[model samples]
Target: MGHLFSKRKSRVTEHDKALLQLKTTRDKIHQYQKRSEATVEKDRQLAKKLIRDGKKERALLLLRKKKFIEEQLKKTDGTLDNIEKMIQDIEFSQIEMQVVDSLKIGNESLKQINAMLSIEDVEHILDETQEAVEKQREIDALLSGGLLTEEDETAAEEELDAIIADAIQKRLPEAPTDVENPEVVLPDVPETLPEAEKKAQKEKVAMAAS
Candidate 1:
């Protein structure tokens, strides 16, 4: 939340100030150039008028002054170009500074993370976790009558098999435990049945076959 509300610090530096000053100089030069151009044109027109009025020396002097002002204006144009190049260099330098600052921040963040989770620290945490899991398993074994143990995997397996067998036995029908002996009276056995019974038996056999 603090980060969300915080304002970023200004990145402006000496280079920016220098650039502003240079631009100011360039603008002043531009104004001077305009004034110089106006002066040159005025001189040129005055010189022509002087020549028509037969003041040849004065017209020549005015022409000389006009040439000097044009030279100065040209020099100012070169200066303006240099200033523009300087401004571009300063701006590019600012971008470079930003890149460097970003790299520094990334490096610092990595350092902090490494410090927090060093190799030794991570190894220690893993060992503690393994020990805790082993202790929990022991506790569970004690609670379950020590039937489960890491060192005795066969015992745990045998216990599971026994439990399954018990479940199966419970699901099966119980066998009769009480036996009653009954006497049977002997009856006469005839070698043949009556005609109707014999015929009915034959029809039942035929139906089953079909």
Candidate 2:
């Protein structure tokens, strides 16, 4: 069961098939070139033997054939180079096509997003938000204006003044109450000066009697 599931099916496109055919042809040409090289070397060895045996014409013919095979081998090498270049160009073209397709998709997605969200829509949203804020401001102003009438404000100020005056009165010292009156002593008058005079008269009388 694992083997059955592990056999993953791969998709092969026409491009892949074409590249496979090209590589196969290149491999076949390479193999043929190798065989031709071996044949050329063998023919050269045989031509040397033919020269030693005095068969000059046959050896020259063999050398001519070897030359023709070398020329054909060079042509095959050119074919291989062209095939490789074509394969590389095809692959690079595929990459460029993919890049163009990706850019197209991205451009379409951006267009969709721009279509959904436009400048007008954004401006409308901002206008609504501004209107809402203005309404809220008006509401706040109305409420504040209604709550604080002139009479209420004056009464509140008077009440606050009364509270402040009461606080100040509480901080002052209490007045004195039921206080006693103090006695003030006065100096005596000089109405008793006749006593000194009387003492002097008595002394005079005593001198007369003696």
Per-model CA lDDT versus the true structure: 0.78, 0.78
Worst 10 residues of 1 by lDDT: 176-185
User: Model 2: which ten-residue window has the lowest total lDDT?
Assistant: 184-193
The residue pairs in collision within model 1 are none
- Runs of candidate 2 with Cα error greater than 4 angstroms are 1-17, 52-58, 120-210
TM of each candidate vs. truth? 0.49, 0.48
RMSD (Å) per prediction: 15.5, 27.6
Q: Residue-wise lDDT of candidate 1 within 69-103, one digit each (tens)?
A: 99998899899999999989988998998798779
Best by TM-score: 1
Candidate 2 lDDT by residue in tens digits, 1-210: 123225446678788788889889988999999999999999999999999999999999999999999999999989999999988887887799769866966677777778889899999999999999999988997878765879987886566545544544565566444346335434433323265654554455456658
User: Residue 16: error of model 2 in Å?
Assistant: 4.2
Off by over 4 Å in 1: 1-7, 113-210
For candidate 1, give the lDDT of residue 182: 35
Q: The CA-based lDDT of model 1 is what? A: 0.78
Q: Where does candidate 2 clash, by residue pair? A: none
